[model samples]
Target: MTAALDAIDRAIVVATQDGLPLVDRPYHEVARQVGISPDEVMNRMDRLLHEGAIRRIGVVPNHYALGYRFNGMTVWDVADEHIAEAGKRVGDLDFVSHCYHRPRHLPDWPYSLFAMIHAKEKAQADSLAERIACVLGDLSRGHLVLFSSRILKKTGLRL
Candidate 1:
């Protein structure tokens, strides 16, 4: 069920949706914009997290700017019984940025587990895929690394 957000909660969401201000005290800045006390801002944010109104409050870094140019989405055909454990193991790899399960399209597409790997070079990306393969081992029936040729604009959800 979706949490019912009050006026202050909505204001807080709008104030920080694009990203909190790059200040030493970001919550304080958010409070200032939302016309509330910093403590209340933090408390509401905490409550929002617990209530599932907000999924996460964290930085979304630009990998390209950070010299991680090679972006590959590695798809794995993992056994149904082992998907949960396989996802956890794949996500734990230091080089993997994101890992999750995707519904497979039989015959054409058998991949279910998808992991995003970033690297500074093409070879590094390949090496990262190898590491993921090592982790999956017998669980992975087959896998493919789809390298991104261009970047799509990214934006946070608006309130």
Candidate 2:
């Protein structure tokens, strides 16, 4: 079920959804745009979070600008019975940005778990993949890393 957002709540989301302004006081900036006090803005944001209107308020960094040029989606062929445990272990790693389970395709694709890893160099990415493999141990039937050739804009749902 979706959260019921009033006009003020909708305004707040619209004001900050693109991204909070890069100002000294982002909340104040949002308040100015939404015609509310800074405190009210913050209070409403807190309530919105509790209501599940927003998942999180955090940074979306440009990894390429940060010199993390190697982006790979590492796929693993894991047994169904052990997928939950294996996914948690892989997702807990510091280098893993994203991890989840996916359905396998018979005869061709056998990978069931996917993890995204980023590094400054190809060798570093390969080493990270090896580390993931070591973590998986015998549970990992096989694995492969598919590197991204280009970057894509990451955005959240529109208001």
Candidate 3:
């Protein structure tokens, strides 16, 4: 496992989550705000990426405003042995924004894989989900398509 990050390292993560500046001296700007040397900022970011403290550093946009207004959480009950492969296949679709495997909660439900798909309208999103389900075939045990009504919060983690 990776070692825990120090306070400074954590700060760097919180600061850069949105994205690094698109300039020749981007680290310099980050260092100025975080009160560290540019080289130190670069080194710390490298360490964070290598140690898995951070995933990818990139920009996150509001898909809705960009015309992908319809967002749906498509859950699937896929076989345990094939869950990973099925999730990968669904994630490969152009409409899929995120996809992963989650444990099924019993009694009332049993979905194992969850994928987020975004499109211009509900029909398009639903069609995309159906196509993904068809691809999984027998491995797909059950599926639910839940359309998003609103976004409450979208922010980065605070250090």
Candidate 4:
């Protein structure tokens, strides 16, 4: 990640950190800005991904802007020993945006598995939460859900 980048690489990073142009040929446009060919842009991107310079390159839509109003964070008090396997199963759920195990704070917070569920309504999110609960089965001691009343725009990090 250090010696792998040059001026042109930095230029491409700057051009795309926010987003690729919403055009027929966004890579071409980025190449033009970076003083390179479209194929060069693609090649560099491929290299970056192959070398693990970047985690992922993809579109991150604003679910709230797309009418997904009910944003819920579902938590489950899963056994620490079984958390890894349970998180994997929950992450595979279609309605689950992402699921991972996190450190839990005792005396108040006891949930270890966390997943974000999105839907157009509260009821829909609740239903999705139930599905996740069923998947967890008797593995989890309990579960809780909290929904956001307002949209929280997620602007992917750029630098």
How do the residues 19-110 of candidate 3 rate in per-residue lDDT, one tens digit apiece?
A: 77767888998898789999999898888888877766666778877898788899998878998789788888876778998898885778
Q: Rank the candidates by TM-score, best first.
A: 1, 2, 4, 3
Instruction: Point out where model 2 deviates above 4 Å.
Output: 1-3
Ranking by lDDT: 2, 1, 4, 3
lDDT of each: 0.92, 0.94, 0.84, 0.87
The runs of at least 3 residues in candidate 4 whose Cα sits more than 4 Å from the true structure, single-residue gaps closed, are none
Compared with the true structure, what per-residue lDDT tens digits does model 2 show for residues 1-159? 256899999999999888999999999999999999999999999988877888888898889999999999999999999999999999999999999999999889999999999999999999999999999999999999999899899888879
**Count of residue pairs whose backbone atoms collide, per candidate:** 0, 0, 0, 0
Q: How accurate is candidate 4 locally (lDDT)?
A: 0.87
Clashing residue pairs in candidate 3 are none
What TM-score number comes out for model 3? 0.79
Q: 62-150, model 1: which lDDT tens digit per residue?
A: 88889988999999999889999999999998878899998999999999999999999999999999999999899999999998889
Candidates 2 and 4, the one with greater TM-score: 2
Q: Looking at model 3, report the run of 10 residues with the lowest lDDT sum.
A: 150-159
Summing lDDT over every window of 10 consecutive residues in candidate 4, give the lowest-scoring window: 150-159
